[model samples]
Structures are given as structure tokens and as C-alpha cells.
Target: MLNSVYNKKQKPSTAGETTQSNKSWWKEGILYQIYLQSFKDTDGDGFGDLNGVVEKLDYLKSIGITMVWITPFLESPMVDNGYDVSDYKAIHPRYGTMEDFDRMIYGLHEREIKFVLDMVVNHSSDQHKWFKGASSSRDNEYYDYYHWWPAEKGEPPYRHSLFDPEGGWDYVEAVDAYYLHTFTGNQPDLNWENPKVRQEVYDIMKFWAEKGVDGFRMDAFQFVSKDTTWPEFPEGHEKDYVKWYGLRPELHGYLNEMYNKIIGKYNVFAVAEGTGSTFEDAHNLVDSDRNELQMAYHFDAVNLSQTPKGYSLLDFKGVFSKWDNAFSEKGWLAIYLSNHDNARLVSRFGNDSDDFRTVSTQLLNTFLMSMRGTPYLYYGDEIGMTNIDMPNIEEYTDIEAQGKYQSALKAGADMEEFINTLNYNSRENGRTPMQWDASENAGFTTGDPWRRVNPNYTEINVAKQKTDPNSVLSHFKRMTEVRKKNPVLVYGDYTLLLPEHEQVYAFARELDEDKILVLLNFSESESEIELVELQGLTSEKVVIDNYEGTAVEGTCITLRPYQAILFSLG
Candidate 1:
């Protein structure tokens, strides 16, 4: 019955259709993510601001980014890089004023680029007026705005949290209650069960919509709806918060309520951070007729490959093929390899060795751009940026990275090796200042950056790549050019080619008579493209290639190490 309600009332009827006229910008457009603090800084500030993004509108437009998703630059304590919102209505002073935000939005619109702001509604900073007021006394008007358990009765109920120094619950002496925080103790989870709190979030969305901002990327969205009964984690599952702790039943109803109130009314899309979402949950969240989220960043596809241990091509194909089949006729997925929350793709998921770094990244980029659903490119990712070797924990500024390091130390793990792992896997990898040029601080800032710029910026930067046709940034620009001209890339039937390959990830996207095949050699060893699987669909036109010359030789296509070539099939 619930599925029926979601399907009949909310899911878009056009999802099953493989036509070019999907009429949804979210499914067709390219979404570029901007980690605002690391993007660019003006006024000599150590951190980047909204005004800094305004200055880069032309560059973004030139790169063919259709929409921009700006990370949380709202007023925050910076405990979680702006995820802990202290004020929903105000901009962080360090990131500039409300007027600067207005300018950035207008400038993006001027460049024909839609803007999506990070909507961190799952939790708020403990310093927020509402949270502060709620903790002050039980009699306060905002006392029920957050989740707090009275400790006077008994020990606070046991639950899992992704962030808590000691445990999930933090005791407050002022009110003799333990407040819940899905993240850090300073960030308390909001009570979505409370109608008033939900209304406040809706009002916040309305305000931003009225300001002409396009959409919201819901952060930690799965945790917003909890059981509230204070259920314990199942036996043998104590600290695994990501799996057993999210996607409660109440979440769907609440999201539906929010969708009807704001997103549906405003004609703007909402893409949820679907870290914990299962296949059915993802379908329920983004299925067109479902009246819920428009798209989601499902990690099942990327996680299979984005790790320091390396990944197999079969694993990569399996994950994406699973999603491709799951959302084929109903929901939508966000095609992204890197974002502000994860490590750099080239250094993590990709082979960033000297011989393969550029071409390997180009191959990955080609695969991402040619995939079904929208593609999201994180800042600095287009220029083949690799993770920086942050040798010391003292140089790290990410709260989660620090917390993980402290946890590792307490666990008595090797500190040196742990730091190495952090450098390879930390979210700070993606937070490094954007490599704009060969200037000091990579032209991101004249002043010292809030985070260190990657040292490879001198060779890998927008300014250098803009003129080099074979550069990764140029490859990205060319891929977008191809994507923009091909509707099949946006709304087409995806068929995995050579799924059992050991070092190649190839696939074809088809819409009616028009089809394009994407072939990627994910190895540093030269390989041959197996044409037997391609059947009679021969390469009609070479759309793009990372290497200069063609490798097609009759029935067998010889691919250079990490080479990628897209062909228009006849």
C-alpha cells in the first residue's frame, strides 16, 4: 500500500520512457560541486567566500558545468566544515554576508548555471539559538525542538551515532538530560517528529527558494527520521551507525511531507546524500512519481572502487550495473566520483601513477559523463588533482579526520601508518584549495588557505589545462560538450559491455536509433577492446579520445594504457 501511494501519487510517469524529452533538468544537466571554503578567496581572507565563487562564474561556465552545488557556507561553528548550522538565515561572517550570497546566486544565474545550496537540516549546532534555548530549560518554547532524554529517570537510552567523543548521547548538566547528536556533541540532531521543527525547516527552504536559489542537497538526510522509541541496536551491531542506524520507516512519510510543502511547490530539485540508502529505499526516495527527492548520491557504485586497497573492474561494473537496473524505470541516481565529503578520485579510486594519472582520470571522467543520470564534478577534480600527503595530524583541520585519528590512537594502531591512510582517504583531500593557476597558493588565495593547497597544483590547474587540449580539464570540457549534444547520455538504456573484463570498464547508452559506446581502459597495461561483445555496432564516429591517435584496428581495438575513446555507434 505504501509503495502504491508512492508510485501512483508521486513517481513520475515518464520514468519508464526512454525518450530524449524527459523534460527534467536534474536528469539531463551536469551538477558541479563547489567546496566554497576551498574554491577561491578574495579580500585576502584565508578562507574562500561567496564573493570568491562570484569571481569564478565565467570559468565554471566555460567548463560547461550546468548547475552548481555550493557546500554549507551558512553561519556555523566550523566544527564540521559548516555542516553544523548555528543560523539558518545568516551567512558565515568569514564566508561573507548575505549580500555576497545574493551576488553569487545572481552571477550563477547570469551564467545560466542553476545553484543548489547544502541544506543541513538533520542537525544544528548546540550554539544555535533554538538548541541553546532548548537546553536552557524544559519550559523553553524550543525545548522540544531537539532530541533530549531526561537523565533524572535513568541512564540515557543506548543508540548509535556517527560522531560522539564518548558515545551517542551527551549529558547536559543544566537540564539533567542527554541530548542526541548524530554527529559531534556540539551538533544536536533536530526532532523531525515535532511538527514545529518540520515547519521551521520548511520555512527555511521557502526563504531560500524565494531568494532565487535553485535547490538543496539534503545532508545526512537518512537520519532525520528516527524510531523515537529509543530502540537499541541489534546484537553484534554496536558502532556501525551507517548500516543499522538509518532509513527508519518514519523517514519516508516525513520526506513526502517536506516534498509536498517545499520542493514540489517551488519547482526545485532535492538530491539526498544517500550514504545509507538501500536499493528499495533509493527507489522510494527518488522515483519520479514519488513526490520525494529528485536525485540522490548513492555510494554503492563509487564505494566499490573508491578505496586505498584498490578495486576490481568486476566489482565496479557489478555495483553500477545493480544501480542501473534498479533505477532504470523509476528513480534517478547521481553519477559522481568525488565530492567534498570523500577523498580525491584520482588518488583513491583511480590509478594516479605518473604514466596513468592523466589518462586514467580522463577515462573515469569519460565514463562518468557518459553514464545515465546526472554527473556531478567536484572542484579541482577536473584538473587531475591528487591527494596531498599530509604527513602530520597537526596539519589536518578536518574534524572527522582528527576524530578518526584520535580513535585510531586510542585503539593503539600505528600512528604513522594511520596518518598515511588518512592522507589517502580523508575528506580533506577534496577540501584542498582549488588549483586555479601556477601562482602562489595556486591562485586560490594570496593569504594562507584554511586548508593546504595540493602541491601538484603547479602542473595540474585550470589555467594550465585551459590551453592544453590534452589536459584532464580540457578532456572534461570536451566530455561535457559531447554530453550536451547527446540526449542519450542523459536518458538512455545502459548496457554493460564486457562485464567480465579484468581491466576495462565499457558500456553503451542507447535511446531509440541513437547510441554511443564508451570504452575505458582502467589499467596501466595496454589492452585490446573486445569487439565480439559489441556485435554489429561498429564505431561510426569517434566522439572523443584522450590519446591523440586512433587505436581501432579492424575487429580488435588496441588501447594504450589508461586510454579512453567514445564512439558513436551505427
Candidate 2:
């Protein structure tokens, strides 16, 4: 049985009671992401449900995670997974009923784990009652519930914009109007400009909160409002079309109003998925004064690359510097190496070899968890899960990958090149079923999983890692313990040490009288550092190491391939 580290009403510091304070809970708390579809299947339905999550509360609490962020389980058409909601008030039948949702919420609360649900308000499935009524006729009271435009002279509105990836926009012949869809044609963008729509959304949010959800992770939040004029961008900047809809000057007013009406009254935690936002955008949304959200997940750090493909090659120094500057000047940042939408960190940053992957994973955890921000851990990240190698487009479930593959082919790219890119960068790599054991389907299900399990489950399963003291899972637990034991890591000032080191990352976190230094060797070879070089911090004791084990010395220290060390100094 999983160990119980938390209990109802136990003090936050004691591991039993959930903390109610807004001051530092976010700063010190650890958030775990649960992709419900692949977590655990109950009743052998070949899909994970709310009941499955309820049964795993003890497993989460045992790992020292304080917050649980589950992706959308609301009623949806599943056009883009659950992102296209048909009814915000109802639960998806495939996942479970509303009663099941309540049970999961109360169970999490009983275990002192705050449950966060995905709030997809940016758009709704075309089948949503609101969209349905609006599309039936322009004279309907719900006509203004979504964005709609009419073509001139029997021609459609400027086809210059690629709103729907499938080529054409949906039109209601009876109403003689076309609706705007930023993603799939089946998902229509909500008209936030309408007061009725805004009020309705607020009421829906309150309804869920009253049901016992502790918080929400807003999806595509920045795109809620758009320029109603639908002005066409200059043809010169066709490549930058995606940016035309984000962070309008009027966005803050809409967000502030929504927060005041729905989020403010409940005093719940909220984190927006500000996909195309800068640090300034984050500050405007989640400053300390709590004007908007409590925090936001920014994609700046994750966008770094090894090729000039998406954003330029990953610049370590530039990325760290930007983060340091942003957090110091604005609000706290949410640090993560991988999520449900990105490739695994181990595969992206370290040698594919198990030993090196283990070390690099630990190093990443230490660096991110020790920083002055909330840390989020993806499901399999704690045990060093690698990216799944998808053999063909048919094996992928993510719509973005499929669209990109077809687009690449249309753009004259060879099939082999497209496949290679998809294998390395597609989001499906992160969505494979969790590796729980070496048993069939990685022990994630009694039957076949919705998605294929990683073939490496035999070596990377959680069952084996939990029993091994030095496994990546154990290292993650140790890292969490260290964060809890040392207040410096929880509420400390972060200062990057030796920023000039090309292959080494070093930093110091200090709080009051306590100080800790984190050193990471980012390469597959040994690196040495003089004790005096660590900004007057003498290597008093090696608290943890990703190498063989922690070793203490007087003058200098050596780190093995992809190793990391945490030292406590007086």
C-alpha cells in the first residue's frame, strides 16, 4: 500500500492539513498534472475515469505533491481532445458522471490535496447548446453567443486568415453567415464581448467551485477576446499570423472584469495558459496584488530549441537570464521541464542512455524545484520517462501533429523528413500511457490502453523504481523532502552563480540565515569546480548528488557525467 503522508485537517506544515494562506502556498507547493485519459482505467472500459483518479489519492499524497491539475473532463465533442467543451456544467459520460466528479473532489480534499480542473472558456464545441442555438438563426437570442460574419456579394469573408486548419470555415446556410474558429471548424470561439456570455461563464465557474474544485487552469486564456473587426493582417507577415489574436490592449479589462465577478469571490487559485505571452503579459495577469490570476504557465522556457526551427536554438544563458529578470521584476513564474504538450525532458536534454537520463532528470528537478516559483511535475517525469517513438501518423492522436504532417507534405517535404520531425517533436510523445509496471499495458490498465504504452516500460516502470532506493522516483521524493525541510528553497532569493560556465549551471538560493548551492553538470563528461568559485560559499556538506552519491571535500568537487550536487553552506 502507498504510504499516507497527509490526512484531513492536518496542518499544512505537518503534511495532513491543506493550507489556506495565499501568501506562500503557491510558492512552496508542488503541482502534479493528471491527463485523465491515460492515468488509470477502471471497469476495463479502455479509458481512465474520475473513479480511477479517486483511487489514486494515496499515491499522490505519498509522493508529497500538494496540488492536482487534471485536464478537462467536462462534456465535449473531443474534436481537439476535451478542449472543445459542449457543456461546461456537465461531465463527459466517457469519464464519469457529476457524482463521480464530486467524489474525486471530496476525496482529494480529504487527503489535503487541492484539485484544479481545466477551464476551457476560449471556445466551445459546435455542438454546444449555445453555439447550436446561435447558429440556427441570426434572429435567435443566442445569435451573439459566438463570432459570426457575413460574406459580401455571395463570397466568403477574406480567406486570407487560416482560422481552421482543415481549409474551410463552417457556415450556416439558413442564417447565411460564417462563424470563426481558431482551431478546428467544429470548435467556435466564444463571444466574450457579450455581457450575457460573460455572465453565463462566470455562473458556470461558480457552479463548479461550489462543487469543491480548489482552482482552475484556464485554457487558451489569452485568446478569449479578439478584434471584432476581424481586420486582415498585412500579407508580408504571413508567417506571424498566430500572434494576431493574442493579448489585445482590451484583454486586461475583460480579464479583470471576469476575475471580479467569478474568481475574486471564491479566493481560489488560477493559472492561465498564456501560450504566446511575454514576461510582461504574465505580470499583468498574475501580479502579487492578485488583480488577475494567481499565476500563469508561460511557454518561453519550453520554446527553446536545438535547431532554428520553431524559436531559435536553445540559449541556456539567455533563457535563465530572462526568467531571473521576469520573476524579479514581475510575478512568480511556474517552472516545468515537460508537460502533457511537450516532449520529455530526459529525451530532449540528456543522453538516451538510462543512467545519463536519470542524472539529467534529477538535475532538472533540483534546478527547477529550488527556484523561487511554483514547480509542476508531469506524470511520468519523476521516473525519467522518455519520448515515445511514434512510427506513423496513424499512431498519433494529437490533432496538431496530424495537421503538421499533412501540411509538411503539401509544402513539398519528403515523408521520411516529416516522420522524423513528428517522432522527435510531436506532443503524442508525452501522452503515452504511464509506465506503472513491467506487466501488460505497463500496468496502466487490465486491457489495451487508448494509446500505446512505451516499449521501455520494462526498464522504466514505477513498480521497480519505487522499490529501488536510488531510482529516479526516489530522487524526486528526496528533492521534495529537501524543499520541505529547507525554507531557503521554499522562500529564498535565487542568484545564478557562475553564469558564464557553458557546460555547467550553478545557482544559490538564500533565505535569512540559511543558504544552499545547486550545481549541475550539463554534459556527458566530468566537470570540476573550485569551492572558492561558488560565491564565498564553502562546500560544508554535500546534501545530495546525482552521481554515485554525495561526497564532501574541503577545496574542490568533481561531478560525473550529467551529475548534479546540492550543498548546504553555513
Candidate 3:
């Protein structure tokens, strides 16, 4: 079994019996994701580089982070923020040289932090040599490297382009054909059906693995294998497009091939961007005997709320509970609230308003840490960063936002309403410069930042929170500590308590003789929760609490606004 590597020794339970631990470092270790451009800047360039990341290795270790996933800094035109790979073997000059990358990896390893490279193989930049050759002439050796439809074919089947509202096919005059780009025109989707393309991708992985990259987060990989026949779908199929275009049966063969050729050879953790269209699809990709990926990273919970109306607590609970139940026995899961592709965690999930921000942020962190999977904490989230206000469309920097705005204009959508909603959902809201201190540009850079820093950085920053023991930063560090000490938190069974509770989310984790109860109040009002499941178990000492204190009596607890508490049960 793939998880056999996880078999180890666990902490002794209260019954004084030592149990075998199913703790995989990838499963037990907390992952910190660094949005490269905003993390820290060296050489006064206003852009973060590999050296800047090396300088902060100690800080990442301070927060109890055992693994770090840095976003793409590979050679690119920066068209889709390094997702469009121009050269797989070279480092972009803007970020730094190959030597810097080697040094950065060494630094992370020195701190015992595993490195996870963001592998974007779904597409390549049009400027890439292979793409350039493929586009130049149909007779070229790289002509079949990408998907193309002949101009004489009278337009390819309807395909959805996430970034380009216009369409997924772009006509290239040189080859008299249209190329497919699920994202933007500059990013042409690679033809995974081709054996050569698969080998090319495997070779790239081998190169990185040789460089000591501990793992690979396959970006947009669910969409990598497509139906080359380009079958047409009924109208509005785009709404549930993942079912239509993602996770084709053939993708499994390619994944198995890659696993045998690269992943298994390296013995590294591999997680895909999306968990196909259903639970069965997710399991097929990640089940231990499947010999494919190791972890399932789904967007069900994050996609639940994208508007100001907020999401239903019932829906939130259902989504998480259903996923946990699906993967409880066999496959593994990745737990996270927000990442580079979404808005700030606190702003979208927790209360980002002044009075509730701090406590609410801490509450969300508690939920993440106590969950049944590896928690991926985004950079700047430890300091409780809020979404920056971008009232105007002109202020947005993400290609997804800009391209979608153009599409809305062409569709005659309400421009004012669009910008307002985009402000709440634009990924750029989460990509702002990291708030390091109260200094200019929040001390992320000595030079003017590439993007505007959030004005709230004056009050919300690592420097300020580092001193306050009750601050969100400290709370995050403590949660990591608690999780590290409790092996049950990583491999224990999760049972959702008070599943229909309006303002409070409660759950319990248990492994053999050790049991833990976690309660979280998601709203800004004082809430009380009485867990029927807690009646038999005697509540022991508080393991960790977001607020200064927790009020517990019998089977009930009065939770203050955004209060979160975890208690051991005897």
C-alpha cells in the first residue's frame, strides 16, 4: 500500500497503550504555500525572488511549517503568472538564477522543510520553443505537440476557455489552424494524447526530482487529458463542465505511466489541482492501490461561497462532511480554506470586519488544524490578511479577472455590478504583497511594490502580531504545535457534531483510547452548542482555545463570538 511508509510509532494514549501511527509526513506536516511574487523581495526589485525565500526559511520553520509549496517561478512570459511555462528546465531571470534556486532548496532542506514545486504541465506558453515550432509549420517535428484544429475544418467543437471569454480556440495564421487553450490564448493546452508529450512531461518531472524537489502539485491536471475527438455538448454544459471535459478514462493510463516512470521512482507526494467530477473519480485517482496520485485536492467547500450574500452554514457543513466521509477509510484529502486562486480566507469564510476579524481568523485556523487531512496554510494568512478593496476593474491584476471583465463587456453585462462582485472574488485580492510590518510597502520590498499593498497592513502584519501572544499569528503557531503533538488529529475518524447547527461547527476526532472534541463558532454573535455525542465522554483539559478562555459545563458550552476550542476527552 502507498501509505505503508506512514506506519510508525504514535504517542502513548491515556490507557498507556502505544499504538502504531499512520502518520505520513505529508499527511501530518502542515504545508505553507508561498505566493512567490508577494512573499518577500530582494535586490529592491519589487518582486520576490528565490533568495528572498531562502532568507525567510527560519521564519517558516518558526511557524512549525514542515513543507513549503512555492508557486511557479519557472521560466515564463508571466502571462498567467508562471502557469504558462515557456521553459521547463530554466529559471526566469526576474525571480533569479539556477544557483539561487539550488541555494533556496538547500536552505529549506537545512531547516528540514520539504519543497513542493508547482508543476504546471496542463499548458505551455505560446513563446515556448516547442509551441513556437508547433505553430510555425504543420510539418515541423513539434507540430503535434499541442492540440490543433485545421482551419478547413470549419471551426473546432465548442470548448470553454476559463480565462478567455471569447473562446478556447485561437487561429494561428502561420499553420492555418486553431489551437486549444483552456485558460488564455497565450497558454495553449498540451496534447497529452501524444506519447512524446507524455514523455516530455515525465522528463521534466525527473529533472526536478533530481534537483531534490520533494513533491509536485499538478496544476490544472484534471483538464490535461481531453477528448481529442472534440465532441460537442448541449447548451449550458459549461455550468458543470468538469463532468464534460475533465477526468477522461484515458487520463488514468497516463497517470499510471507517470507514476511508474517518475512519481513512484522518486517516492514523492503527488496531488492534483482538482478532484474530478465525483467521489468515485477522486478515489480512482488517489486510492492507494490505484498507484496514481497520493492526495485529493477538491474545491467543493471553497466554491461554496463566492458572493457577498455568503454561504449557508448547512451547505458548508454538508460539503465538508460528505467529503470527509468519502475519503475516511481509503483515500486521503487536503484541507484548506483559501489559496492563490481564491480571495483571502478570513474575508471570504471568516469575519474580516474590525470587531470580529482577529477572533474569526483564529477560529478558521483552528478548524483547519483540527481537520482530518494535511492543512495547507497560505502565506500572509497567519497574520490574518483581509481582501484588498478593488472598487474599479482597472485596479485588478489577475488575467482571470481582466479577461473575464472584457468578456462581460462584450456580453453587455452590467459593468458596475461586475466590478463590485469581482472585488469580492478576484484572486488578486489574495495576491497582494505580504504585510511584513508597518513600514512603506509593508516592508515586503524596499522598492515600490509591483502591486498595491493593503492599507490595513499598518495594523495587520507579522511584526505586530509576533509580539502579541493572543494574535492570530501566535494562534496559528500554537495550532500547528497542537496538531503535531496529537497523531489522532491526523489519522483519527471525524464525526461531525451538531451538523445542522446554524452558527457553530462542531466535530470530534478519535483513535482507539484517545478522543478530541472541537467546537467553532463561525458567526460574530455569541453561540451555545450542546453536543449530544459528548454526553458519554468526560471532558478533559482544554488542548487549545482561540479565545482567552472557554466556558464548558456538562454537554454544553457557551462560545463567545468566533471562539474556537479543542478539548481532550477522557
Which residue pairs clash in candidate 3?
Answer: none
Give the candidate number with the greatest lDDT. 3
| Candidates ranked by TM-score | 3, 1, 2
Worst 10 residues of 2 by lDDT: 10-19
lDDT of 1 at 404: 80
> How well is each residue in 1-570 modelled by candidate 1, as lDDT tens digits?
011110112222222222234557667778899988898899787798888998888889898888899899889988888999999999999999988887777777777788888999999998899999999999999999998889877987676556554667888888889998878898899999999999999999888877876778999898888668776667757555556667887888888888778876664788888746468777777766677787867877556644367777788888888888887877677898888878888887678877778888988888889898889888887888898887788888777887787778778998887877777788888888988999999999999888777788888888888888888999999999999999888888999888889988888889889888888888889887767544544445788889876646565787888888888884
Better of 1 and 2 by TM-score: 1
Instruction: Give the number of the best model, judged by TM-score.
Output: 3
Clashing pairs in 1: 10-289, 10-290, 11-288, 11-289, 11-290, 12-288, 12-289
Clash totals, every prediction: 7, 3, 0
For every model shown, what is its TM-score relative to the native structure?
A: 0.94, 0.91, 0.95
Sorted by lDDT (best first), the order is 3, 1, 2
lDDT of 2: 0.74
Per-residue alpha-carbon lDDT of candidate 3 for residues 1-570, written as tens digits (9 for 90 to 100): 112121112211111111124446678778999999899999898998888898888899899888899999999999888898899999999899998998888777777788899999899999999999999999999999999999998978899899998889999999999999999999999999999999999999888877877789999999988888778888888889798879999999999998878777664778999998899999998886787888889999999889888898889989989998998888888999899999999999999999989999999899988998889999999989999998987777789999989989998999888888899988998899999999999999999889999999999999999999999999999998999899889889899888778999999999888888888888889987777655643334788887765556677778899999888883
